[model samples]
Target: MSHPIIRVAIADDHPVIRMGIEAAIDEIPTLSCIGAVGDSSALVALLEQSACDVVVTDYAMPGGAFGDGLQLLDHLRTHFPDLRLIVMTGLDQPAMIQALHASGIDHILSKADDTSHVPAAIAAAWANRRYLSPSITQLLPARGAPRAIAALSPREHEVLVLFVSGLSVNEIATRLDRRKQTISTQKTAGMAKLGIDKDADLFKFASELGLRTARPDTE
Candidate 1:
């Protein structure tokens, strides 16, 4: 039996990566390239204007109105709950990959893997199954992810979430209506609890735990 054509959209900050994904889609007889855009805003606009079955989006496409990383992914998941999403990310960190799964993203393709994996990810996502590329798969077990995140106090959880969501300590303080020193201390304490020393590792850890939606009391 012949399969129905799957309409696909590509969203990546790099023009070359977008072109590569489009090219891959063109080679698949059952897949059609609907639209390709550079950032989150354009992707959102494209989805609004057109219908597609699957989206292959970059993990870190900064400079868009919706921001990037977990923030962009959360927006897409929230607004397009029924849409099949295939995330393409160069961040091979185990925590981040686990976080993507925690956020209900079942398809993740490593950019380091060939663009050929794009079609496979699309197929899996369309069928409501999980698919992770070779590199991303190897990065797992992602052990202790849950316990580490659960160790944080509510306030520390709130601070870490805001920090990884791209807010500085000062910005998070203003947003939460707290003193900057308090925010900084919470961030530091959270990192210590998570056993994360560097800011980069903290981003990975926080992302893995799906903390973007955490709402602790601000008062």
Candidate 2:
């Protein structure tokens, strides 16, 4: 039996990137490029009007009804619960990678990496598996390294989990029924315990410790 076609969409600010990805999608037998848009607003509008199985988007795209980065991802996740996302970006920062993972994006391809992996990434996302480009994987803490979560107090761990799961400090405080300052303190303490001084490192640590919102079935 023939496999069902996977309707895919592309969103990137650069026309070259969008067209390149569209061309790649055309080469895959089971994948179809249903829409290619320049901004998140256009992408959202297309999604609302059409059916799409997967979305390959640039993380840093700006000027949309919803702006880019985590804001765009959050909006998409909230509005389209079942849509599979594949992020294609030049950002290979440890913290950003961790944040993407925390936000439940399973397939991430660095723009610097081989485009040949794009098809694989899309397939993996559809299968509920994760595909991280080599550039991103190289930034992860070495496996078997001591996990920072072990050093955290229970409250600190709780706060870190919520924060990495894409909650703002104020939101976390509201959910935990604690003062925002208290939540901030706990977050700081947890990061310190983990030797993490940057926001990205906190996300990296949480991701390494499996503290994100959704765990991938496969790496």
Candidate 3:
């Protein structure tokens, strides 16, 4: 007996990553790469033009009008609920893991996993089954580490986005109509919840998580 083809779409900000996934999909007999896009806008366009059953997307894909991270996922869920989604990420932050799970994502793959797992995940998703890559399974906090759900509140998210976007505490307070000390406290608390300390690491964390609306405007 034979199975129907599963048309797949790839969404990632990195061209190299997209190409690799495209090649992997091409190698599978039952899987077809319908399109590969570098951002959410192009992904949306491709889906609208082509018939795609599954989407393999990076969690941190930015540079799109729809934005990335939870925002992008929400857009997909709302517009393409039937499409099977496989989220790929490099971060192991418990808060992020909790957020993704809370969003009802079934297949989460860590970038550290071998590319071969991508085919396995695609097959599982096409079958309507949950599949977590080995690396992703290891990253799951349930395996021993405290299952922390330090999800930032709405205000904390806003404060961190502005801070990571290159705004000073005073500037953020002014823009948000909050006190400078309050903004500082929120920023510090957000960093602590994410297990980050230094400013450079905070910027990297925000970028990796797509917390900012976009990349920092200034260097």
Candidate 4:
């Protein structure tokens, strides 16, 4: 007799996407967007402070002093184990999706995905079901994900991911805040460790690393 009550949170540095999500949730019958954050630190605070059943967040947040979506995912998984997650990113790769899959991300949506699919993705995550944007399903290359992931050292792994995301050695340097040469060496070492040969291979490797699946482990 009563519709389900789903309190939701959204995080993204982008205005259009955040506005779109807020608008959509406002129109939905049983859902509410309670907290919307522009930066990762704000997101963490919102999570700790708000009451919500699911949190939908952008995969990459620019101007986010803490832009690593994976890190937020990990923190949520660690501190709010019962909270559900929907991960949306413009970067859809086999490795990234697979990593999110392993980390128990309930839904994976692409920004280019149909807007109608957003509500459905939220519903699936609320139900503890999984959904992925069709484009993500089709385009994510699964071939190298597992092998490449197994080969990465933790730091090299982090460097490899930032590198492949088109972050320059300097940007990566700035994000990681290391010296330019240090970032260069890390890139070189990560490349050697992963045997990344070309841009194509670089993408394949990023996919498996599950940069989206950065959930913290309790055990």
| Candidate no. 1 TM-score | 0.71
63-151: candidate 3 lDDT, tens digit per residue: 99998877888899899989999999876765556456556788988888777888889999988998888776765566433323235
Per-residue C-alpha lDDT of model 4 across residues 37-79, encoded as one tens digit per residue: 8878888788778888988888767565555556667777888
lDDT values, one for every candidate: 0.81, 0.79, 0.80, 0.71
| Model 1 regions lying over 4 Å from their true place | 142-197, 200-219
Q: Estimate each model's TM-score.
A: 0.71, 0.66, 0.71, 0.66
User: Which TM-score value belongs to model 2?
Assistant: 0.66
Count clashing residue pairs per candidate: 1, 0, 0, 4
Looking at model 3, the pairs that clash are: none
Q: Candidate 3: list runs displaced more than 4 Å.
A: 143-147, 150-193, 198-219
Candidate 3: global Cα-lDDT? 0.80
| Top-TM-score structure, candidate number | 1
lDDT of 1 by residue, 6-110 (tens): 999899989999999999899999999889999989999999898888989998888789987778878888998878888898875555666666666778889
> Which numbered prediction scores highest in lDDT against the true structure?
1
Please estimate how well model 4 matches the true structure, expressed as its whole-model Cα lDDT.
0.71
